[model samples]
Target: MDYSGSFAQEWQNEEKEDNNQKGRNRMIHFRMKNNIGSVTVADRILEMAALALAVFLVVLAVALYHYLPERIPVHFNSVGEADGWGGKGMIFMLSALGVVAMAICSAAAYNYKMVNLPFSLNPACLSQQVTIIGRMMRVLSVLCGLLFIALMLMTTVPQWGMQSVFFSFFLIVMTSMTVVLIVYTVWIYKKGRQYR
Candidate 1:
């Protein structure tokens, strides 16, 4: 009967449906964006905590290096004069290197948080890549601390020298881990370029 009016009514109905679909899409997009923002903030906090731990380890290393010798009396004349210097120096070197590696890792972590925190929350962000790197640094730090304790023990327990072979093996492992961490850091930086 009234074909023209009927066609106009049909067009209006289609337009309304399209508008509703667009509105739904916008809401979903906004929600996803908000969630990404939250993830990024959480990642930043984790990175900051890691950074603080790194700083503490560095300070501890320094204090141990300086204070240990003076605080403890060298009763070497009684026990064949324990050579604590070698162990202390080795530990000091390890601690210094650990500080450098941790600093690099912290900078990389901060860059990652700053660059990707606002846009998307990628699973790669929480991947073992960063965790492994951190663990590598931690292993090295622990080794240094252990060496410090060994140095103290050497003063009282001369027989601890029997375990030098084990410590040497761990030193090798530490070196290998350090190499892996350096390589991993480079790879992460390269991969993260796309995210940024």
Candidate 2:
């Protein structure tokens, strides 16, 4: 058994493995490029707005933390009464939740092709679907951030017209999210059918 033959065979195998890895990297890059390229101006605006709202929530929580009471309302009953109390630190958690929502939406937008759909779609329709879904994710993120911020405000200053303010914001955000989800899902689903 010549050692040279075995060594050459091992080198060829290593080369093949490297080539396979490069191919995988290229595929990943292509997917990312396609997703990023498909993002429309409206999507970018929504994403930026979502990020800004999330950051604003964190800042608001920080600014009010010291002034807030040691124990604050952290939960409310269906009747709009505060039913659960927690330390002021819970306010920060609420803001952090907004940030988490923003991050999740960002991920979803970046991997729109991986989003689960109720119906099958042709490959050619993926780019358009990506744009639609990305916009929806960004819009949802913004709405979530607003809702969290409104909740934070309600907890921190229940007396300063916050209750009504928060309730209004809550209704708006919920309605907006519902509409966005329904419209985008139906739109994408219908467009996907045309492609098929």
Candidate 3:
């Protein structure tokens, strides 16, 4: 049917357009590897750390449940003075808080593709942002769980004292959080500039 003149050129143009559309579609549906949308090895390791911290908190709760006495030390002053007390039942909340923190973090981490709560949708920067933020969340979750575990353990051992236990806890948490956030911010900025 002599398809070598105007008709052939028309068919070629249509085929080119179809291929370009398919390529765009693929890009739209594609995800950046190792981002929050998918769990990576690093994420799994952090998740395990969180789980370990949760177990430690639970064991501490069980141990203290037997001998925590009627009153539990709930609050510590800036100088590490135990200025507030509550019922022994309240002590369990320290472990409970650890569990809840881990749950919240894990939920958010797994659903990053579904909902970006702490992040806005900027398709251009989304990939790098998700990668950085995912790691940040993992680290923070582990820190939170560990912090609660430490608090729960301190409640069990009165000899640990508010001065050493609470004060050191304060330093460790603040320092860890500060360093993590600072590094994440710098990482994001540098990556953004690189991609730019």
For this target, which candidate reaches the highest TM-score against the unseen true structure?
A: 2
Give RMSD to native, each candidate.
Answer: 11.1, 6.5, 4.9
* Span of 10 residues, lowest total lDDT, candidate 3: 114-123
Against the true structure, what is each candidate's TM-score?
0.31, 0.78, 0.73
Q: Give the clashing residue pairs of candidate 3, or none.
A: none
The window of 10 residues in a row where model 2 has the poorest summed lDDT is 31-40
Q: Write the per-residue lDDT of candidate 1 for residues 1-196, one digit (tens) a residue.
A: 8799999999999999999999999998775443322224545555555556556656666665654443332323323453333444444555555556555644444233433322233344544334433443444344444434443343323343444454455456557656755665565555555454
lDDT, candidates in the order shown = 0.49, 0.80, 0.73
What is the per-residue lDDT of model 2 for residues 142-190, given as tens digits with 9 covering 90 to 100?
8888888878887976756467667677777778889988898999888
**Best-fitting candidate, measured by lDDT?**
2
TM-score, cand. 1: 0.31
Q: Residue 119, candidate 2: how far off, in angstroms?
A: 2.5
lDDT of 2 at 78: 65
